[model samples]
Target: MKQKPIHPALEPYLEGKVLLVNKPLHWTSFDAVRKIRGFSRITKIGHAGTLDPLASGLLIICTGKFTKKINEYMGMEKEYTGSITLGASTPTYDLESEPENQQDISHITEEMIHAATAQFTGPIMQVPPSHSAIKKDGKPVYLAARKGIDVELEPRPITIYSFEITRIELPVVHFKVVCSTGTYIRSLANDYGKALGVGGYLSSLCRTRIGNFSLEYALSVDAIGAEIQHLKNSYIPPAGGYTDAV
Candidate 1:
C-alpha cells in the first residue's frame, strides 16, 4: 500500500495533534482515542465526546498539545441518524442490552410515527434513560441498574432542532436528529415510545456530524491503523493541547 504524506503545517500541529476519526459501531469513543494514540505513538491523547458502544460516527481525537482543545469540541452541537424499535424497552437505550418488555406494534403506522415525532421537535423536557451513565448517589446509574436497583432521575430541558422519520417497518422507525449539547438520543427514543402508548428503545445510532465536521471527511480505524507508523516517523511538533481533541 502507498503511504499518504502528512501535510506540512499539519505536520507540526499533528506531532501531537487532533485527528477527526470516524468510529465504527460496537467501539467506544475511548477505544478510538486509544487506537489513534497508538498509531501516532503519542502519549497525550484524548477525545472530545463520548459515543455509546452501540453508536458509530465521527469521533474527534486529540494528540499531544491538541488534547487541550477537547472541551471546545465537546461544546459543539451534534447530528445523529438512528433507528428505534418502537415496541420494546431495553435496559440500555440501544440493542446492547436486553429488552425489559415488548409491546404489540401491529397497530402503529408510518403516519402515526411521523406525527408522534412532531411532539419531540423544539424544546421539551426529556427524562434521561434509566440505564444511562448519569450519576446517582455518586455512582453511575447503569451500575445501580446492573445491581437490580431502581434509581430516580430528573428530566431536563433539551432542544430537538428537528426529527425526521425516514422509514418505518412495523415497530422499527429510522430517523435523523439534530440536537443541542447534553441531549441524550437514547432518552429521546424511550420518550418517543411513551408518546405512542408503547415503550421504545434505540436499536441503532450513528453520529453523522459535530459542529462543522462531518463523518464524510472522517478517517476509518482501518485506514488509520494502516498509516500508523508513517504518522509517528515524520512531523514537526505543535504547541499547546486542546480540550476537545477526542
Candidate 2:
C-alpha cells in the first residue's frame, strides 16, 4: 500500500487550523465540513456551529487539534441578516415547510413592525420550530413532526442583543440581528409577526458573524478544495524516494 504524501503546507491543517467558510444555501454545516475533510484528508475535523440547510453564511470549521475549540466558538454571539415574510406562517417557521394561514398585511405599518421588534429584543423565551433537529425520545423531533405527530417543546430562554429593521416592503421585512448563541432567528420572525397581529415566517436568512469572525473572511467550499489541490500539487517527494513517515 502507498502512503499519502505529506506536504509542509498541509501540516498546519493537521496540527490545527480554524477555517471560515461561507456555507452555501441548502448546504448543511456538516456538508461543508465533509467536503473539507474529503479534500484535505483530515480525519479530525468538525464545525463550531450548526447552520440549517435553509440558511447560509459564516460557518467556523475547525480541523485537527482545533476541533477542541468548537464549544468555545459555539458559545459566541452570532449575527444574521435576513428577511421575514409576513401575512403567512409555516409549520417549520421558515420556508422548509409550506406557508399556511395567510393574513392581510395591508394595515401592518412600519411603526407597528418596528415596535414589534422591541418585544423580542432583550431576554425572551423562544419555542423552536417543530421541524428542527432537537432531540426527543432519542430521535429528532422533526421526524415525528414529519409523521404529523405533535411534540410539545418547552420555551427556552434566549437573549436578543439587538434586532434592527433594515427595510420594509409590506410582506417582506429585511432586518439584522445580534443575539446569544442559541437564539433562533426563525422563531423571532414568527413572534414578531404575531405581535403585529399578522402571521410571519422566515423567508431568507444569512449568518454574517460569529463573535469576532466575520463572513467577509470566509471562502466557499470550492475555494478551499482548490487550495488543498494546490498544496498537493506543490509537494515534492524526497530525493531518495518517499518514506512512510513525515
Candidate 3:
C-alpha cells in the first residue's frame, strides 16, 4: 500500500549528513531510505544496517559523501531488547508466522531461565531463519519457504557479548542482549527455546543501540522529514537555528 508524503523539508538532505532514525514496525529499512532519498532528491543515500520489518529501533542513514561510512557503522556491536515466547515455535521465528503447537512451559522455572542464558553469552553458531533475507541459489529463502520448500541453511559464527533475562512471565521471557554485528536476534530466540527444550520463538524485538549510537539520539521518520524541510533553500539565506542534530 502506498503511504502519504513524508515531509516537505526533505530537500535539505542533498548536503552530506548522517542521520539516526528510529525505524517503525513493518517498515523495511529500504523504505526509510527511499523516503529520505525522494525527499532530499539525493540519489547517493544509503543505510548502515538492515532491520527486519517485524522489528523497530535505531537505524543509521548516510547521504552524499557520508554514505561511504556505512560499512564502518555496520561493523559496530549492536544492543537489542525484546521478548521471547516459550512453549511454542513459529516458522518465521516471530509474529510474522503462526505459532505451532505449544509445549508445556509450566514446568520451566525462573532459575532455569536465568541459568540458560549463560550458555549463549559467548561465541555461538547461529543458523539464519528460513524466512529471512538470506539467499539460497540466488533467490531469497523466504520465497521458497513460502512455497513449502524446506531450506537447510548452514550455521555460522556469531558472538554474543551478553544475554540477560530482564523479566519472566510464564510463557514470555523479556531479554536484553549485546552482540556483534550480523547477529540475528530471531535466530537467537529460536536457539534459546531449543536449549531449554520447551520450544520458543521471538515475540517482539527492538534494537536499542549500535556501537556508540543510541535510540535516544534518533529522530522519528516524520520528525526527520520536518527537520529537513526546515533547511534553507538556494534562494534563502542561512538561518541561525539550523544546526546538525546528529
Residue range with the least summed lDDT across 10 consecutive positions in model 3: 1-10
lDDT digits (tens) for residues 124-155 of candidate 3: 88888998778889989999999998999999
TM-score of 2: 0.94
Q: Compare the candidates by TM-score and give the number of the best one.
A: 2
Candidate 2 residue lDDT tens string, 1-246: 232545556878978999999999999898899899878877789999899999999999998789899999999999999999999999889998899998988888888888888888898899988788889889999999999999998999999999999999879999999999888888888888888888899999999999999999999999999988887777786798653333
For 1-246, candidate 1 gives per-residue lDDT tens digits of 232444343355455666778898889888887776555545567889899998898999877577788899898989999998888798777787888787888888777899998999999888887787889878788888878887788989888899999888767889999998889999899889989988999898999999998999899977876666454445444665322221
**How should the candidates be ordered by lDDT, best one leading?**
2, 3, 1
**Lowest lDDT 10-residue stretch of candidate 2:** 1-10
Candidate 2 pairs with clashing backbones: none
The segments of candidate 3 whose C-alpha lies over 4 angstroms from its true place after superposition are 1-12, 233-246
Stretches off by above 4 angstroms in model 2 are 1-8, 237-246
Q: Rank the candidates by TM-score, best first.
A: 2, 3, 1
- What are the models' TM-scores? 0.85, 0.94, 0.89
For model 1, state the Cα shift of residue 227 in Å: 3.1
TM-score head-to-head 2 vs 3, winner = 2
